[model samples]
Target: MAEQRMPLPPLLLDGAEYHADPIRRALSALAGDRAGRFAPGDLAAAMGSDYTMTVTPGRASVPAPADGTGGVYLVESAAPVTLAVTPPHATRDRIDRLVAYVVPAQAGGTPGAWYLAVREGEPAASPVPPAVGAALVLYDLWVHSAASGRPIELSDMRLSGGQQMLAGGTLAGAERPATAPAGTVWTSTTTRQSWAYSGTAWRLLGVQDDTLASHALSGSRAWGPGVNEQAVDNLTFGPGRNGGLIELSAGVVHLSRPGRWALSMQAFSDDGTPGSSKVWLDWPGGPWLTRDLCDTRMRGGGFAGAGVLHQPISWTGVVTSDQALNAITIRGAFTPSTGGNRPSYMVWLYVDYLGR
Candidate 1:
């Protein structure tokens, strides 16, 4: 039995605005009596130009019939054209619903490429070509510079959605380094502060409360048969101020060096004798030199010399004497070097003694 061929539907080459007359005539000739009922091989042979048709999966390139209704159609134009097709409702397989063509190159003729995409079961107007929609959506796309890449110039680009352009790290807006300059010392701006550094430790500089206020020791003003018992008082000390007596009660005096020193006290005498007066000095933890007042005459009479005494003997061992009393007294001034480069010293006296 001979195979029966399906009848080709009519062809409606609608929207032929810019289609070449020769190409339309060629298509019409190929779709001769059954113009739309073209098989794959027949359609390929009919568009007799130098182009190729590649049918992807689920897609076919069949020919449209001549009649305008119930037949396939091809619309071609240059100034933007739309091709509309209405497939039968029963056409479920996408392969049976649409047709596309590629214009082939003729001898010595310039050939340009076009595009066609078909959606199944859509009405003639439903699948409008996306040129307008694509043009509208292109307004939303933008580009930005990455940290590792060169910065994008805003003047040469377009951006949407309030995007801001930032300069690159190599540009003037780069981040600054967070390091300090070498040899720059950090010191506090307070008078009561100190800066200290150890070779093996971190340097520290700050203000701390002076802790030698109520714990200092004083000395006797008068010499006596029972030892000079001095009632010393009225003292103030701090960092910049005098660091009062570091009371060493029979404590080990670490003598890193040795030199001439003196033991003196500011005092108030009540009975006008060296044995009957109140003296003020730091506590005695010294190998202090002694000053003899044997020939030193008393200024106010009655055996009491109301002044500081410079003891005139040098020693290095610790004096383990409990002869030091404490109200506000200091005992020794041991000069580590008698040659003038002495450690700085500051001393305070009782300018006003409000003893009750």
Candidate 2:
């Protein structure tokens, strides 16, 4: 009878001729299937300490896989072992490779096995390092041509991994990766923002704070009870803060990104009068027509004359523009009578961005 070559689940038949090859192949294939679940360079957690190296001391510590278990293949070291590295080349640069390799069994008592070694490479401007068949490259030691006594620096080594979900450090807008696998996250140090790739494009993550367009009161200017005008202030722009999506001018906040925004304000009035003070927000030509007028009235006799009255009001609504620009106008006035009266006033307007 021809013997089965590939591995399969072991099964027995009554009074059937039995051999060791089929059983061994089945068990080995099962184990290989399990090991394949992990990436090529994944370090087995329970096996031993992660393959770590000390550059200055030129030492390396590696954990051997127990019996049949290993990162990619079994290792020869019976237990955790350390290896000393040879000194760097005096006149040429090279890469020292730490690798785990498998050796097939020989004809004698020698058995198939796995072993770890630090293979030194030929020195050159860009040297091609040696590689064993199916070996797991644990780390790369970049040795530059240096004086004989110089210590190895941290910048001269790199730990190898099967994959990286995150890049080493925060990146700038220009430094952001041009292409990344889906689900990879890139953070920006300059904007303190992050984006996640979705296989097609990068999308912003987390809440974005609204721009502080303006916050001030029309000082020294008294209104005629119902006097209202555009809230004005000296505009200051933060470099690259809003990505030009929002801008602040004399008294108007420009919203170039179409989305919902929470509009809020506080108005104050005190003019030896006994009436109510009011403030309201509006974006005349945009989707958000008007916000509720907030009012504050003097409480009692002691608070009637020359007493300050301030009230805060807020509204969350959507603003849209086909041209990607919307100008929000913040207006304030003192309406003492049910009709109209005049007085000095203070108004504070705040705009916060809410997502689409």
Question: What TM-score do all the candidates reach, one by one?
Answer: 0.18, 0.33
Q: What is the C-alpha lDDT of each candidate?
A: 0.26, 0.49
lDDT of each residue in 129-157, candidate 1, tens digit only: 22221110101111121322322111111
Query: Highest lDDT among the candidates is held by which one?
Result: 2
> Residue 102 error for model 1, in Å?
65
Report the C-alpha lDDT of model 2 over 7-126, residue by residue, as the tens digit: 443357666666543554454353342222122123321111232453212112222233423333322233454655666677877777766555444322445555556787788878
| Candidate 1 TM-score, C-alpha based | 0.18
Total backbone clashes of candidate 2, pairs 3 or more residues apart or in separate chains: 3
Provide the lDDT at 62 for model 2. Answer: 29
